[model samples]
Target: MYLEYSSTKKREALKLERGLARVQGPPFHHCYTVSPASQPPMWALRRASVSLTLRSRGFNVGASCVKLAPTCCVEEESGINESREITYGGFLLPKTCFHSGYNSSLNFTVGKRALSSSSTKKEDDLEDGFSELETPASDGNESDNLLTSDAELSDDDGKENVAKEKEKTRRGRVESKLFNEIVNGPGNSVHSALEKWLEEGNELTREEVSLAMLSLRKRKMFGRALQLSEWLESKKEFEFIERDYASRLDLIAKARGLHKAEVYIETIPESCSREVMYRTLLANCVSQNNVKKAEEVFSKMKEFDLPVTVYTCNQLLLLYKRNDKKKIADVLLLMENENIKPSSLTYSILIDTKGQSKDIDGMDQIVDRMKAEGIEPDIKTQAVLARHYISAGLQDKAETLLKEMEGENFKQNRWLCRILLPLYANLGKEDEVGRIWKVCETNPRYEECLSAIEAWGKLNKLDEAEEVFEMMIKKWKLSSKTCSVLLKVYANHKMLMKGKDLIKRMGNSGCRIGPLTWDAIVKLYVQAGEVEKADSVLQKAAQQTQLKPIFSTYLTILEQYAKRGDIHNTEKIFYRMKQAEYPSKPKMYQVLMNAYINAKVPAYGIRDRLRADSVFPNRTLANQLVQVDGFRSNPVSDLLD
Candidate 1:
């Protein structure tokens, strides 16, 4: 029993030392030196005999020091002597677990200090700092080899992880052609691919289908995701769980609307109930803002004994906020009655509603309640508070809130973004504008994207403006207003061909060219002194839109041509304006008359037009005519001093 106790204690000590060694890397040493024999000698010993042998070897069993008896045999056969190893012959005081290595000197060192350059060193073993030199060349084609396919974007911190995930998924190619089709091809093609595989006697696991379905949804290819789900439901080989049906219903809600989603709910098997389907249905109601339907669904859920969550209540509250704010109280009361816990989002939205209604005191109380409930204010909440302060003209309060938010390095979400982006832009906060621009680009509304693109132009970030413009065009179809804003960007950058191509694309897509688009083109060309191009855009805009140009647009064209002393084109524009029934502005003809006068041309042409019109341009033209060689009809043109 004594020997067994000692042996157990030794093993425990060895384990503890090894643990310590792992924790204290590099400087520690292992406790025992391994010596290989035909078999492990320690196995043959009696329990007490092993203890006797351990103590007899001068090991001092409990002591930290482990000494080795000499086991070296000196052989004198060759000219050069080599170390011969028989067995263990070294002291070990271990903290680092190391495998055995033969050392003839048997020098044991423990817990050595880490090496640094300040330590004394010999010339033969010299170490020096790196010399000043140019950086090494990089492979230019390396960037070309980077993953360019649009993988589903993750958050900023998860970028590397997502990249590595994509890399691994890309490398772990499955031999199954069906799996390849699902991955390589997007959407509904996955259904066809799976069918092809199954028809050939192939099988699929639940995990594979679930992952593929999830991947499709993540990529926002909902149409294809629904197709796969429908195909699977039709197959006798596979059965979808409750969650699968719920997910399919959600995709329907998104791709279709609440009506179709309701139809989808009817088709669900009796196995699915309010508890399983509530989230997807409530999310649809949230999107559709169908208060009546939402209320109906909530009542049905209560009838079916489904537990209400804060998210469901939040949606009902959102619908409530749209019409009767008093209905918000019912939601809160329902949440309390149901014992549903509110998340930070719940409190934040409540605070925002209170702030917006000008119930500052109520807002503050909710904030206090939030703190009491241990719900911290997030970016959206802070943004709402700051905007309220701004609206109340409390600049200092807004500044304080912004500073606190900045100190936390808080990333803005859709809520804070929509509120604060225009505010930052209007206030000329360029850096904040840029940071907000990145957040806005994730899923920007047309108005916000147009605002961001114009803001980038204001900051002279031409490339960034172009990038945002392209992204907006690719993601959402542009309206006349958006395209006009983009045209102005191209004008500012002097990329005329790009502007021309953009306008052409707008036409090809059956977008009507509004007066604003024409004005934008005319203004761009007029500012650049391209009178001919400006006139071309105006005529096409007038003809294609079948609507008269705004009086201001006509005035701009007249003014630009008059400034160039091109009386002929200016007069032609004045006649077109008259024909278009644009109420006459006297500035139009006076500009042309002055042009004819300064160009040393007779006022004969101007006088003839004035004579034709009695009221319009009569006084304005007469005033300019008195400046040049007194108005005379049928007179030859001549230079005048």
Candidate 2:
């Protein structure tokens, strides 16, 4: 009983050590060892034994180490060692219950034999006697050749076991880590976690890891997801697990901003089920804008007894329509042969697809198909069709759709408003646009308000734009982008005081003003010849964007200072430019040179300034500066003259 408790404690300690080893990596001894039998065998035995016991108890202690150990004796023997036999005898738990049913077996051997130069080398060396067999080899046959069969068999077994063990470890780690992360959060980098899994010496399986990564991507935590996916592709590890590999490649392709996903579905392993391979291939085809491949995958999926989902089929139709509506008709014919019933989404996809391809006639067929399917096209669907009509410049058709929608008891669906309002505004139906804006005020979605405000802005209806802007601020709480849009609208109308007020209101509302605000202020001041104020705004803008003021703006400020004969301010702006590493433009050089000339600076400084500005011959202002009269008396004279 004491022995049993000691064994349990020892097993627990070894488990803790093995877990530590997996996290930190194989120990220093593992790397420097000449042979597994020679390296700190005591530590390996304890750890391996503990892992064995824990695995026996179903605790998921990995099997790779134990599986790797036998491979040490798996090497091909030298020519002189034909008579030798290698015996590996160790405790491997039975496939049954613990202490009650357990019984020990001795003198076991793996089906391969190689030499071990230990003092106790024979089978009889065991405390319990076990018999051994010897076989004769022809004298001319080398010992190495005689041992070849054993070596080959052991090597094959070792590889398979090692691969299986490593796969288990990787799968265990991935499942546990993902479960923990989902329960908690992205506590550790998923890519780093995957890297650790990859390091387990397992045959790489892309599908399992890709699915894991795709889940992470959906949560917007794409950073590590992208890294692992790229690593998998570069290593060609993607071929082993090709099932969902294509689907994950789709995401990676999108994330990378590629025009198409660059994966060959045929490279996927035959071991993967048809459904996984089909979906993944279809997904990749769709992501890459290759509807032809998608259709091919769809057709081939049938052979695998894998039915393409309505979602995938819809995507294929879209791809066809986007690339060519003539292909869309072909897709419909294929779907009809397959007896796949089109859903509202399927119909919507057809309409949207035709709209994108400018296939108005094709869109009419889709409308007819929707009626045939007993699916009444909703306003949202109508709105999509309206957009198609709008794109075709068929305002009459678009207005008809909108008029039909208005005649219905429109329940203020923000989605419908977003689609319909733009069409109305584009059609010069300002009254209809205004009515939508009023509806948006009562059922205010952030998206609806922005769309309404933008549509009003397009119509140059400043009062209506301002009304919605103010209402958006009060209702949804102003975001910086929203406020910036309002500021831009005010600036567009040359409402300087109102723009200024909006800037102040932005601060009062606790909305951040970005570089846009500063640029707007500086531009207004420069246009108004309030260069002093413009320079002040420019200074603030520079601090915000961490960018040096451009030479043109600085030159304008310097021109104003030079006109007022404020040499101190002009020098300050010049030095500020140098400190900020602002590149001196030809216009800037001309402005500064003229400033020095007009300020009555010495002839030497005036000539040097002209030389500096004259570097660019096409810069007319530099030539004009030196020729203009009383440049020494008034910098303004150069401008006025």
- Candidate with best lDDT: 1
- In candidate 2, how many Å is residue 535 off? 27
Runs in model 1 lying further than 4 Å from the true structure:
1-190, 196-205, 337-339, 358-361, 387-393, 408-423, 431-464, 467-641
Off by over 4 Å in 2: 1-221, 224-253, 256-273, 288-312, 352-362, 390-397, 406-409, 412-415, 466-641
Cα lDDT of model 2 overall?
0.46
lDDT per residue, candidate 2, 580-631, as tens digits? 6443333444455556657766424544554453232222443545554333
Scored against the true structure, residue 616 in model 1 reaches a CA lDDT of 31
The number of clashing residue pairs in each candidate reads: 2, 4
lDDT of each: 0.50, 0.46
1-641 in candidate 1: lDDT tens per residue? 00012345445534543443333211011143332121111111111122222232223433243332211100000001101100111101112122222211111112221011111111111111111010111122111111111111111111112333343456453333333456554443656777776777866777677676655554445666777777887774476767777888888876676679888888888975556576567656644445446555655555455555555655555554433333344345334334455555556555555555544544555565556555566544566677666666767777677767556434532434434554565445689888876776666654467668777776777787778777766665445656777788777677788788988887787665666677678877876768788999888768874444655667778877777778788889988988885433334556766677667675655555544442233333445766553544333444441
Each model's Cα RMSD: 34.3, 34.2
